[model samples]
Target: MEGIKRIYLLIGQKGSGKSFIGTLMEKEFGIKFIRVEDWAKKIKKDRNVDSEAYLKQVFEENENEIRDSLTDMDKIVFESTGLTEHFDIMLESLRRDFKES
Candidate 1:
């Protein structure tokens, strides 16, 4: 079975070009790019919950979904806002997963 060989976590302030870099990676190198905020948006839309109150839950679910989708992928990039304390859980999970890879 194929597994991830490389992981890029793009961490920076908001309005920086992390997502742009991720997009460039996706387009130029065919690496899979996972944007956490996009996942949060989808989760909010699907669950109809308050994001501020349920951010941890949303991020946990996002991490789970990202992990589940990693099978057969070799390179992946995650675009994240490096400003939230709550995001640490997901970041740690990603680090664990990438280390295992």
Candidate 2:
């Protein structure tokens, strides 16, 4: 069997089952899940802002981590609201990494 690293971008509105899907993916694929909100808190140490700014910083930081992980991990699940510019930036960064890799 061939092994490939995957970076899943879960995009959905509130209460749209993003978390549920992430959990399912983790169980079914044995992939590690990285939630943007939790990552932002760990990265920035601030949780008082609204989702918009939080997600932006998360994307910026998470994208770098994702790129780094791709070299070692089999799969990484990026769980996010996917409704902000930050998400788009992260996606673009992922694409660039894919091309470079």
Candidate 3:
């Protein structure tokens, strides 16, 4: 698979402008914007359960989806609160796999 040309990570606190920037990027640059929190919320609702374990599982699934997208996508954007072990692990994996990027 081809490496992604660009990966934009928007890390910020709640009520910040990360989401705004992500939206702008998607609309203006045609980049794929991934909002992890929204996806996590959807997963929680679908499962009808609440637990850190399940949240972590959802995070891992999202990470895998992002990694998989590196094949066909040239650019991608991600919005996160910039906390959690899962985020750290995902960053490490991205660094390892896309060292050139």
All candidates: TM-score: 0.77, 0.74, 0.83
TM-score of 2: 0.74
Candidates in order have lDDT scores of 0.76, 0.74, 0.79
Using lDDT as the measure, name the better of candidate 2 and candidate 3. 3
**Ranked by lDDT, top first:** 3, 1, 2
Model 1: per-residue Cα lDDT over 1-101, one tens digit each:
55436777888888899999999999999988888888777767556444565687767876776676676676778877756666787778778757743
Give the alpha carbon lDDT tens digit for every residue of 1-101 in model 3: 65447788999998899989999999999988888877787678647435667767767877877777666788888888867777787778787877654
Who wins the lDDT comparison? 3
The list of candidate 1 runs beyond 4 A from truth reads 1-4, 45-53
Superposed Cα deviation of residue 58, candidate 2 (Å):
1.8
Model 3 / residue 91 / CA error / Å:
1.2
Q: What is the lDDT of residue 93 in candidate 3?
A: 78
Overlapping backbone residue pairs in candidate 1 total 0
Better of 1 and 2 by lDDT: 1
